[model samples]
Target: MSNQHRMHGVFAVPTTPYNADGTQNLEQLAAGVEHALDTGIGGILCLGATGEALALSRDERESQVRAVVEAAAGRAPVVVGCMAYAPAEMSELIAEAAALGADAAMITPPFYGGLPPEAAIAALRIVMAASELPVMVYNNPHSTGTDLQPSHLVELLDTGSFWSVKETSGAATRVRELRAALGDEVEVFIGADGIALEGFSQGASGWVAASAWLLPEQCQRLWDLSRDGRWGEAIELWKGLGAALGQIEDNPAFISLIKAALSRRGAEQGPVRPPLPSVDTESVDALLSTIDGIEGRALHV
Candidate 1:
């Protein structure tokens, strides 16, 4: 309800680490979270798309949440992704996150296709009713067929139960439209990395991105530049990193690229889980070269 718990600036979605045996490497995950916090990220989001939330088991999800929360250590909010097709299951996930000391739950509408918008909205309302922590509406129609139109968001967010919305439509204009429609009724965060500058120009309050995890200082610089109204400088900064950001946005190896970049940066995020192969060395090398050209050694080629 209040803006007290709302997150601003960059919230890095750290990738989940795994041991060679495929068990969750929570210690590695916690180390990465601590590193992100040290770079001054506004918050941490566990079990996000970048984190491969759906690939993890329930127990693994709880372990990851606990690791991130402890790693953040109250320096920033820890928002857990609680995505489920059923409202009861979502509520269960939220309860687990709450018990694990998460600050909030980021939820998307049910992923099942052909579900009407009303069903999505109704499902969110039901889950929110049972959630102990505040909820952030994650509208990522690309991954989930259900799209929460601005009208639907107006209805759900107007209830004052939601803390924010992550708009990942990949269209920057949606940020402008949401701002125009909502007018500060709910904080809007840009979930796509490529359009971040455009989203900021259009009044997005923050960013929830994998790039933010891989390149925290640079991403934070972009957020700071935008926040300070230095449009010219922001444009120049974004342009400098366009190549790497483009790879982040459009590559099929979205998660893999982020992980490889993090490992290249010396954070050591291991392989992605099954069904999702790691990006080839050639792709990783090319991305690293592009990243190095940005003039920061924080990301070595």
Candidate 2:
């Protein structure tokens, strides 16, 4: 598929499911892929922040990517997150994803010891040169320590090195700026669920949403309403889902919350791996309450 086609619409970022023993759960991964596709999402982004890519070992990461790709079965495009602190490592991850049939790769700026803008660009150049799959630059300044300024992003885009950018700067204005700067050359996907409406209003190509993992239908409805210029309905839908979205935005244990919510709905989403604790009973109850409020149905909590 063309980059434009793959990059548009609701792209759900699924959490990687792990069994009680911390082993990869391909069954749940497959179910999650099917569930997301059933919601009419345009694409699936595996091993993303929501997926806890950094927490998984290389073998587990590859298994999760392969599972999602296999389960998707071409119903929608799959974009794998290739987040690494070095060019060689990132390139290898991208290669694994490409071999597993992923349509694209999403990369963040090198972390740990932050790369300067020029160095970051150089790293990206190496990864881009190493793979044929389309690339989506992920701008997550909070976690990456290095923010890709608009000018720097434009420079990278000018190299024809990237197909899109997942803007997590939490600034809707940045989306507008990117659109104004690069026009249609680089698609800008909003990475913050809280600012999705604002980003879409500013011409964001789509959303890379964690909330969409469990609430895909609602998320997709909002995306469609906004994309079709039905601002009134879009805003209303967004308001209705705000409580659920806020849980993700406010909670540091959001991945656990997401998996818990899915489990409440009867999916064997499994538990989050250690170093990342599971949500407390109160938090889980609150999340389910929020979901129930938006869904208007008592989930099997």
lDDT (CA) per prediction: 0.83, 0.82
Instruction: Point to the candidate with the largest TM-score.
Output: 1
Record all residue pairs in model 2 with backbone atoms less than 3 Å apart, i.e. clashing: none
Encode model 1's per-residue lDDT on 240-274: one tens digit a residue: 66668888777787788888877887777788877
- Candidate 2 yields a Cα-based lDDT of 0.82
Worst 10 residues of 1 by lDDT: 292-301
What lDDT score goes with residue 189 in model 1?
A: 94
Which residue runs does candidate 1 get wrong by more than 4 Å?
296-301
For residues 74-141, write the lDDT of model 2, one tens digit per residue. Answer: 98889989888888988888888889899899988787657787788778887876667888988888
Error of 2 at 64 (Å): 1.3
Model 1 residue 129 lDDT score: 69
